[model samples]
Target: MKLYSGIDLHSTNSYLAIIDGKGKRIFHEKLPNDITTIVQRLELFAGTLQGVGQHRGCDREKA
Candidate 1:
């Protein structure tokens, strides 16, 4: 099954989500904002993952 991932990145943590081609969520979690942790998690699905995307934005107050 082909998989896709999206990450909502913040200052201290990030929300990771993976979905199948039919748009069913297979995995979702909140993880620390560390590259190693993220990479390791993604590696689990490397065989089937098609791509990964991330979104980072500033807070209204900070912007």
Candidate 2:
């Protein structure tokens, strides 16, 4: 079963989501901005994950 993940990154926290090939949400959670924790959580799907896509929040100030 192929899996895919998407991450919404923020300054203090991030949202992680994993979905199966059929578009069924398998896991979802909000985690801190820690690489170790994120990697640990995603390790379970390492073998089946097709790719991980990340979207970072843009907090740029208007000039």
Candidate 3:
């Protein structure tokens, strides 16, 4: 099944959640509060996660 990803960024760290079309949580993690780290973590789940969408400072959470 296809998958969807969402991220929530904050001051200290960012929250990430991945869910499948079937409504199952595939993977979740709180990365190093940086965009690069977020991308790297997602890459590990690239095969299962796609169509990423983020907000709340997530777009600017970069090195």
Candidate 4:
């Protein structure tokens, strides 16, 4: 049941997607560009998250 997550981030909005080791999607949504909101979504998979990935030009230094 290993889980993974990916985010396609944008300036104003983003897409958050979660999937299992088998590549089956468990959760996906378009959400606002707020850190708290993003964290909340991710919290759903708290202890099970194996890895996470993000795409786009957002600066990782500030994250």
Highest-lDDT candidate: 1
Please state the error at residue 14 of candidate 1 in Å.
0.3
Candidate 3 residue lDDT tens string, 1-63: 678998887888888988989878888888878778888878877676658888785356568
Between prediction 2 and prediction 3, which has the larger lDDT?
Answer: 2
For 1-63, candidate 2 gives per-residue lDDT tens digits of 999999999989999999998999999999999999999999989899999999997899999
Error of 4 at 50 (Å): 0.9
TM-score of each: 0.89, 0.90, 0.73, 0.86
Give the clashing residue pairs of candidate 2, or none: none
Backbone clashes, each candidate: 0, 0, 1, 0
The segments of candidate 1 whose C-alpha lies over 4 angstroms from its true place after superposition are: 61-63
Lowest summed-lDDT stretch of 10 residues in model 4?
54-63
- Off by more than 4 A, model 2: none
lDDT for model 4: 0.93
Highest TM-score scorer? 2
Model 4, 9-60: lDDT tens per residue? 8988999999999999999999999999999999999999998899987567
Against the correct fold, how does model 4 do in TM-score? 0.86
In order of lDDT, best first, we have 1, 2, 4, 3
- The CA lDDT of each predicted structure is 0.96, 0.96, 0.81, 0.93
Instruction: List, residue by residue over 1-51, the lDDT tens digit for candidate 1.
Output: 999999999999999999999999999999999999999999999899999
Error of 3 at 6 (Å): 0.3
Query: Superposing all C-alpha atoms, what RMSD in Å does each candidate have to the true structure?
Result: 1.7, 1.1, 6.1, 5.4
